[model samples]
Target chain A: MKKLINSPDSVIADALRGMAAAHPALSVDHDTRVISRAGGAAQGKVGLVSGGGSGHEPLHGGYVGPGMLDAAVPGEIYTSPVPDQILAATKAADGGAGVLHIVKNYTGDVLNFRMAAELAEDEDIRVSAVVMNDDTAVEDSTFTAGRRGTGATVVAEKIAGAAAAQGADLDAVTRLVTEVNDRSRSFGIALHAGTVPAAGTPGFELGPDEVELGVGIHGEPGRERGSMAPVRDLVAYALEAINADRPVGGDVLVLLNGQGGTPLIELYGAYAEAVDWLEGHGATVTRNLVGNYITSLDQAGFSITVTALDDELVRLWDAPVETPALRWGR
Target chain B: MKKLINSPDSVIADALRGMAAAHPALSVDHDTRVISRAGGAAQGKVGLVSGGGSGHEPLHGGYVGPGMLDAAVPGEIYTSPVPDQILAATKAADGGAGVLHIVKNYTGDVLNFRMAAELAEDEDIRVSAVVMNDDTAVEDSTFTAGRRGTGATVVAEKIAGAAAAQGADLDAVTRLVTEVNDRSRSFGIALHAGTVPAAGTPGFELGPDEVELGVGIHGEPGRERGSMAPVRDLVAYALEAINADRPVGGDVLVLLNGQGGTPLIELYGAYAEAVDWLEGHGATVTRNLVGNYITSLDQAGFSITVTALDDELVRLWDAPVETPALRWGR
Candidate 1:
């Protein structure tokens, strides 16, 4: 388990220090390990915030920007950011217009973020949060965490960021984010496993000939294990699961997401396969995306999310967002 | 050397068939092996095109949409799409507005795209290209492929996708894309190599106690091997390389790219280290992106890309884009 770090425990602290030094425009709350812009966004603008385990790059922290999140709380790799860190983010993002916290649906993430929100309220800072539970891998399942929040986090952040950037009030931004999550559904698969730097080993053992289906981000075992098949069959399985959980509206914002290890070529191949299935089914893919957006550490696989889009949501979706992870029309 | 396919020779063809089945909105030319939207965007709009190997999913193909790219040519995993495929893309994207090819900086990508561009000229379709040679890992030397492009491919795609979406002329779009390539630099590090499905073997070897520095997308050997250090130092090495190569400019767009297998959490961990280094150097991380954008199949590593930005290009970049890969800003 050789890695680029002096010690597993010190990786996060040292990284925070380095980020603080490298980007003068970004200010790091060393005490809390929260990252925000130097002066934070303007006052009177609803502050948008997001936080989670630190492994997903450009997600919580990389997304801290002008048209996006005001600040983000980062936890250690595959670990939740502490309650205190979340509180710090809520406070920094509070611009008198209130704050909205975007959280992915993971047990630790939910608990930690919710606790942070509670702590923020105690501080007299009006903070509202929305949990993104869009992974559609299963329903009424036991053995694992309920449908994991896979790809919807990206949409939530973008839409919420846009609303916040437009000066939408906290309630409005929170509602918008929730609405997007409500309209989104996701399903995932993994070909290989990634290592938790702290654990110093691969998350799971995957025979070279098999891929884990419906795997969670933390290397949670997938729903099924099967021989890797042609891309079309994989698309069929992913779409069947995602489409089954399709939001009521029919119009969908499709996301073909790569788990940590899959390559871009494979992602596109899968996306092409997924879209073909949707089109053949007489379904319309109103908006679509493909890439390694929200990823499980280094698992080799991908997921798909379809967020049904409405005119208002689509407009907000098109709004410029400037984050390290996503920047276009910014 | 474990993979699911029946045979390595069948990978590309099988993948394409699967892609066609999944993405009906995309027309896959079996003969030419090109993937294009079923219907082109505005007829007079300059068409945006890009592509490379099969494993970098969602890249050239997933980017095909309203405000991004019109067509993406794909090759075998980690292999350049042949000249014929590039020609197919050129034809499919040849609306009256001409075409702009966004190519990553690879020896094969360069040779193949250039040859296709020459072929397009013979057909009277005006074609321009911007070769994205952003990786600074391999310094100028006779022993290398001259800086291989890494993460800047995303920046070039997004910005040029915007300009083309805004009805910018082919030349203008091409120029902007080239400028971005010129101003950007990238560096990568890998902990472990991925198994190429086609090759049925690891792309490269890494000792348990070491990692590779300055690697490319084809699983190419990096500049050197060294004992793993703190994530911060690795990031510094990358940022320093990118920063040194970066042209003097205003804001900078930085990308924390995971090679195929590095998990998002690890990518973020790497980001924490890299961004800190970037900030300390007085670089304004105006736009930050962290994810697996450009990748080598399933290699466990990450790369950093920084592109200097100015207001105009930034504004153009802020324009709405809705691709299968990047769908946030519609």
Candidate 2:
């Protein structure tokens, strides 16, 4: 309930205003709830577009810029953006090369993006989609019918956006996204639940000594809750689950992301433990990010994302990126 | 009392390990507790070095890079780093020109950094110090003798670091830092208290509906406490106080900083409010930063920093920065 917002109803709209003011490079359309690069789509370049519910910030809207997403449509808190907004973003971001819809695997998001793609195609725009289902925490969660997408959404957006910015064809960019998604896996834990602004309370609660493991991004139920242990053990459990499914090894990219509310110091601590665990398992993490890149509101927890990287993916990731949320190598 | 840490005793060391693993561009000396550029000091460049207690992350540590501090020393949570660590960082970061020590105006930190400067003098390394006391919240607090430094540390580091990186001498860099400190003013509000790891609890407490109006970075007592109002009113009050003393006008740079635990969405909302307030008061905010640049450990609130910019500071502000936390134009 202690959130810095005018009202629950205006969080998304007001935040968009703030985003527009803070970053003039990205143009935010209040009417359609779309944030896009100021220059719009480039001719003959594959356009990258993504959208989802609000709350998990710096994900879609924060990623919209030159070397990442072209446009992003944000819905209300933990609710999917309607097809109209998605269609608007798709049309605005589309160039002669085409548009790629980066859809997370939640049921509402996937369905809406799909509908929007169909609508774009009806309007003579070529559209392709890559649905991300990278979270290894659960096969199905409260808001997702399949495995929910989490940290890999960021990894996919960055790499694929770079490929698109390289003037790759639509097919090539879509293939790169598929390759990145195939190589990435994520798992999350929550020390505290994120409060939904509309609800005026946390969706779930934990006892002072309790913690949630294998948590979803929307403050949904996790795999288990237990007495709080040291962060080393928590990180080990999460990474063990991820590496077991993905069989992580060789050169890899890691993102030890904070699930909001957790301080950077603890995220770095978790990053250290995650690196130790991955190295012990014979994985050489060549590139890594440790911060609140993909967050779940103000939930005090962390997520570990391991993406087995190839030279091409590494090159793409190393390319310049300039956005409000994720910017580097520019 | 919930946090993602190993043992309370090992919080700083463990976090340092994580930082070392995550950012290879910066070399972390575990023994001395210093994070410095990987290549050490560049010859003839005025080296910038800073250190303080841990918890306020990305302040000193995250600012060490090509265009920022040459080295950072971190101590235990909310406690001043020792003279030995500061002395070691000074020696490592000192180039032929000199080294600038950016110390926050906490008593222990002032005494420690001053001692280290004397020690560095004995080692024949030129050292100039700038103690920033820019917090407008309180004149004296739990850990400070004078006004405590908060958000302005980041601003001073960025501007002064750019000056030093441009081959400015120690005196020039010191002068630039003093100018930045003089023009910059910051005010913070904590929705909840920050918990120090060793203490196993928040430094203080607030009622469910109450908030500290001008809280210090370490959860020190602020100017006043009142029932939580809409973010607009809260922002107005803080900015009104800052403008009352400084009379903000013309082109100004703003930093709407989140004090850890707040979500990005809320931060952006606060940013929007701050901008509206500033513009309404006849101030022109030309450049701004909205994020968790300087943070209290897991405290839910934010701080507003405004620096009235002249042409020189504006040019220095626009200079390329390639640090782990703050990077742009590179």
Candidate 3:
């Protein structure tokens, strides 16, 4: 893979160093791979912590700041962080109120975050956890028992972060996060697979005229492979899958997430189709995001995430957020 | 090419539709292909208008907002906007004060923008233009008379847009934009060429182990093609070339821009090396942006831009900007 990296083994560490150099508002703990706000956790507020593999950048790490995550612990590329790393992140995020762990539903990640929560509780800190499984791609995947978590993690982090910033208690923040995940669904399609730096090759291959429907972030097998079609057709297929799982209607927040290598122009084009599809099906988009928020290395693909929104959820989403990846109203 | 577009012919139009759907704060004119703030130009405030080819997104179109451009005109992919479209944008952005056009150094863009400015003057709208040619890779290139304007356009827009928002006259905004271009220098390296949708093939080719150094945004030939090196070495080479053209020292604003296809993690990793190289060469980074701001559709590469900054420029750089792509502050 012709990646702009020093080496595969040092990718996460090197990126963390760069993050430290780039965002002085953030404090990076190199030894523990934890990224937190420069002034530490907010006192008397529920701290939010989320993390996973390193490839999905601007996710967990980029979400750390006021009105968002208190800390992020990135693991190796496509690998879950160790229990020790997660524990360190939990400790760093702990405030007087309590801490909330926003864990994506990968088996490794779920287990590690659970272990870290236990470890934190043993040290006299209160902790609550919410596991996100928003992807409607498949029932099981290579590294996941349930639906693989994808774009909803970003939505969850945002709304929950807003709640925490408003001084919501741990239980209230946990309920809000769980509600966000429950009301959300995602589907992804890949035009090309991303190559891992260590592997130096794409995890899988597709025919020149074929595309993977409902692909996972880690290049796992989707529901099926199909011939290349127009963006409208692709978007319709994704929306159909999501609607089949959960009927999408009413005011919604939409995320048209690019899988790293897709250009912003194309993502915008795809999002237009999504808006049309939603409106045709009785759903009105109230808030939308169109860009690469959760990415998988250099994979050329896109995912559509729809979250049925309430007035409270909409208010929280519009609240000020000051993070590297998602920031506004500050 | 495997792009998420309806068709090669309708890429720009479809993307514009999506942009309109995504950002309600911005108004898009389908007939003229001009994007402007929804509420129209600010009265008595210097209006900022920038435009060019379409592929480098979030450059012109995404920068339309309260603190940025009053209007943007996007042409067909990799093709300059016509005089009519630019003129429409100029008219839409015109206020009582004046209007400023920020043009990149491409031949077609310069010619088209110049024609539009004359047309606007005929209609009694004061118009001033600043041409950006900050690339230090070559003195002359295929589509450019002198250096190719690359990453410096973003810096110019932010600073000039701030000046305009602060009610600077057309002359002052034009002068500040010119000063930014003069103090800035940029260099790019590409691992792979981006495939234009119409062409259905990469603009250029490279050996598996080789990279194109100082490559232009349009896949034009750069300074040289060399074997791939570590991130530090590559960053050092870019910094040395920039330093050779103009000695980089003192307070500076840096942009480590990815060429669409590179991952954010890799961009951050590359940014660390850029910070190190700048500091080692006696330049201190007062501000930095590390992501895909200006891109060449799915090209796997990066460009580094350094702009020498004074206190006023630094303050302007920190000013609030709320664009679709680059946003911060209130």
RMSD of 3: 0.8
Q: Where does candidate 2 chain A have its weakest 10-residue lDDT segment?
A: A218-227
* Candidate 2 lDDT by residue in tens digits, A1-330: 788989999999899999999999999999999999999788888988998999999888999987899999999988899999999999889887899999989999999999999999999999999999899988888888879888999999999889998988889989988888889998888988999988888879899999988888898787899779999999899988888888989999999999889999998988888889889999998899989988889899999889999999999999999999888873
DockQ for all candidate structures vs. native = 0.31, 0.85, 0.87
The C-alpha TM-scores of every prediction are 0.75, 0.99, 0.99
DockQ winner between 2 and 3, please give it: 3
Give candidate 2's error at residue A259 in angstroms. 0.9
Across all candidates, the chain A TM-score values are 0.92, 0.98, 0.99
lDDT of 1 by residue, A19-83 (tens): 66445667888887889978876789988878788666556776777677889888888778889
- Flag clash pairs in model 2: A330-B330
Candidate ranking under DockQ, highest first, comes to: 3, 2, 1
Question: Model 3 scores what on Cα lDDT?
Answer: 0.92
Mark the regions of model 3 whose C-alpha exceeds 4 Å error after superposition. Answer: none
Give me the runs in candidate 2 sitting further than 4 Å from their true place: none
lDDT of 2 by residue, B160-268 (tens): 8888888788899999999999998999998988899888888888998999988998888999997898999889989987988798988999999999889999999
Candidate 3 DockQ score?
A: 0.87
Model 2: CAPRI class: high
lDDT of 3 by residue, B175-288 (tens): 999999999999999999999999999999999999999999889999999899888888889999999999999999999999999999999999999988889889999899
Tell me, by lDDT, which candidate is best. 3
Of the true interface contacts, each candidate retains a share of 0.45, 0.83, 0.80
